[model samples]
Target: MAFRNGTDSWVVVMFFMIVVILFPLGVGPEPDILNKISSGVIWVAALLSAMLSMDRLFHVDYDDGSLELLVLHPQPLEFIVLAKVLAHWLTTGLPLIIVSPLLAIFLNMDISSYFVLIITLFLGTPTLSLIGSIGAALILGARRSGALLSLIILPLFIPVLIFGVSAVEASILGVSSKPQLLILGGLFLLSSALCPIASAASLRQAIE
Candidate 1:
């Protein structure tokens, strides 16, 4: 599932490139300025791309009635939701992290920030997926679910965005990026604890 969704979602790579390239092009060609701004722009683009891809997380299975069957499975819905979330991370989140370094280069970021960017994305994107699943579950089967999902999700995403971009910013300045990553890790852990149950509840409500 992860492989399938990831391959299907590869167009997001194009979006990422456009964001990384066009911003500097529109602003100026200064590599120093580009590096300074690159991490935030790339991460933001990745976040939006992931959000765009998230609607398909359940929509495909739901449309095919597989979601209904999964609901009836012996294992708990929480586990099922976790699986889906993991698949979402593997497909959408991991690839973004993998490509972040090249994007970071284009942005003119220092090499040291490379570790920070990857770690931040690793800690952060899971929280995005978990939160996105909540929105996905909430709007399942509803009209304009794509737009509604973003409306429900974008607000919840602000903290992750702030901390994630901050971590990169800190890295660029040669300051310890640990605190920001720690906060992101804490957010990921909290979301991991609560998001599956929340998603399951939302799924129940939507299906009912």
Candidate 2:
């Protein structure tokens, strides 16, 4: 209980501090500049946060030999991989939604856009977690796994990053954001269905 609490607390605190620093640094300081760049700023922070947080997914278990046991379990490896991805979404992606409003404020976002920001994050970050799992699973045994993981996953992130930021920008422009959001949601559904199976296959290769 203590360990779980400590880990959860640390994760939340780290995410908070990292976003607080990153949004401003990426977007710049002028109020007008921030407003103009806020959509991009928030999306970039989400990307960085998602990337950083994913490295720890299998790392914790891999270090402790639990990853090996997970591979060896009688239950299908696909299900196990799905469970881990779900847990990752719960911990990291869920928090991204919760914290995006504050980050939006820092980016000088209009107050009305806050709900759309949260909704977009909710729709988008799961895809990040899911796609990231593939890279994380593939690079599990590499010497520079972290860097390799980022390289492999970064390209895959482009579509989500594009539509996610577009949704916010559309909202701010008082235009319909639904088309972009629907695209983002479709990407999430596709990734959620496929990424775990791919991650499980990659885990098999890594374990072998």
User: Which has the greatest lDDT?
Assistant: 1
- TM-scores of the candidates are 0.94, 0.89
Off by over 4 Å in 2: 1-28
Question: What digit string (tens of lDDT, one per residue) describes model 1 on residues 1-208?
Answer: 4346345557766776777778888989888777778778877887898788888888887887778778888999999999999988887787777887777777777778888888888899999999899898888889988889889899999999999999989988889998999999999999999999999988777766
Worst 10 residues of 1 by lDDT: 1-10
Per-residue lDDT for 147 in model 1?
88
Each prediction's Cα RMSD? 1.5, 2.5
Candidate 1 accuracy as TM-score:
0.94
105-137 per-residue lDDT for model 2 (tens digits): 776788877777887888888888889999988
Task: In model 1, state the lDDT of residue 51.
Answer: 89
Clashing pairs in 1: 34-107, 35-107, 35-108, 35-109
lDDT of each: 0.84, 0.80
